[model samples]
Target: MKRLIFFLVLLPSLIFSQTNFEKGEKLFRDGKYEQAQPILENYLKENPSNLKAIEYLGDIAGHDKSWDKAIGYYRKLKQMKPSEANYYYKYGGSLGMKAKEVNKFRALGMIGEVKESFEKAITLNPKHIEAHWALVMLYLQIPSIIGGSESKALKHSNELYKLSPVDGYLSKGQIEEYFKRYSSAEVQYKKAIAAGSTKKGSQMLTNLYINKMNQPEKAAKIKI
Candidate 1:
């Protein structure tokens, strides 16, 4: 009789918890981060392994810049779905953010982990555009003595250029500029301007031509 009474009492709580989770999901989708947090916390307390909820919670944490909590949620999600590319990417990005908040030595360690995670994401999904772009950009930012390679950046940049829309010529130009291929960058930026794809392309071209290519007179002629 006591067991039956306990079960009856628990059923409503279970239903209420489910309702809360559903409402949290709806609120999250509607961009109500403040309203969703408590509900999600409660749901996570009850069901920590809920991947969708965990993912959304991690996103909320990231949106709020709560890097530690975001890393925790993403790490949990990654544990559940180790082979998922998006999970690995998010986890890597979170770690990278955390690394930025720390000292240089600690950041270096996290950067190594970040590289591994991003690489795993790319390996899992070769078409993951953001992962590829981020890896290329990170590589360009670091010194060549520490695994950074302008040639590798150019390789990924070319791949991205092929896959990107015609309007993405500015990005291609930026990548070329990073490789010190100023002439190619100038040509790409000019093409973007001609295509009417980017309003800022002319200004960017002016900067690159003057500062990078040492063509101050040519830069002065650019209208925008």
Candidate 2:
């Protein structure tokens, strides 16, 4: 009788907590972060390892550009759910953003962490689009001495091409433009335009014609 009574008492509390969590999650889904944040935070005090709550908290912080707070939540979530590709992507993307705001020395320290997180994300889900985009930018922007490689950037771009052709061509175009390969960049940018990334492609092509190719008339008359 005593054990049965204990179970009966505990069941309602568990049910109530679940209902409460669902309510907060609904608010989160509806984009009411401020209203959802406190409720979720309160529930997480008791269920500190709840993945849903942790992910929501990370998203809230990230939306506000609170990088440190967001990173903390994502770091905890990734630790709890290592196989989740989105967690690694968000964590690495946040690290990349945070690197820009810190001193050059601190930024240098974050580079490896940023790269590793993106790599893990890609490894977990090779078709992850944002992870490929992140890798493309990272490889193109960073110096070769510190692991940057246009070849690697192109590799990811080709991989993206298989998943999303416009993105792939745009990425390759951007990388070529970065290396001042004007003709090649123009070719890929034109491909991107044909593939429906028209606005950005137009801007890039115009910039190339006027700024790099020194064809101002061509830039002015350019159309996507």
Candidate 3:
């Protein structure tokens, strides 16, 4: 009778906690993050070890551009679940965004860890397309002096190609364009269009023809 009484006393609180989490999760899924945050935060306070709650909070912080908060949460997630490829990816991405807002020296200092995190994700999941794409952009955007290399970018782009041919061609085209090799970019972009007929590929090709190649007619001729 005492045990039954104890469970009954606990039941209402448990049910309330569950309802709060469900409500918050529903809001999150519905894209109502502002409405979800406080409820999730309250639920997390009561159920501190909830992984999904932690991830949702991290994602909310990331969406709000609260890099420091996002980094803290994602780092915690990484520590708690080291095998999760996505936590490392999110951690690296947060660091990358934060890097962009700081001094050049500080940003440069962060490069190694950022690269390592993304690489770790790839290591954990070889066929991880987003990680491969992140590396591709990372290699292309950084200065050559700070470990950026066209060869390195191309290497990941090739990996993307093997996993996703359309992405492979599009990324390769982006690299060529970055180097002002418009003609090469054109070829790659055309290949991307041929592979997937993606609007992004079409737009890129059209932009290249119009803006870089100074051929408005060619741009207009291509259908989106």
> Cα RMSD for candidate 3?
1.8
Pull out the clashing pairs in model 2: none
User: Local error of candidate 1 at 68, Å?
Assistant: 1.8
Quote the lDDT for 13 in model 3. Answer: 100
lDDT of 3 by residue, 1-224 (tens): 99999999999999999999999999999999999999999999999889899999999999999999999999999999999999899999999999999999999999999999999999999888989989999999999998999999999999999999999999999999989999999999999999985698999999999889999999988889
What is candidate 3's local distance difference test score?
0.94
Model 1, span 131-163: residue lDDT tens: 777777777776666678877776766666676
Ranking by lDDT: 3, 2, 1
Query: What's each prediction's TM-score?
Result: 0.76, 0.82, 0.92
Candidate 1 has which clashing residue pairs, if any? none
The candidate with the higher TM-score, 2 or 3, is 3
Q: TM-score: which candidate is best? A: 3
Better of 1 and 2 by lDDT: 2
TM-score of 2: 0.82
List model 2 lDDT by residue over 124-166, tens digit each. 9999999999999999888788899989998999999999999
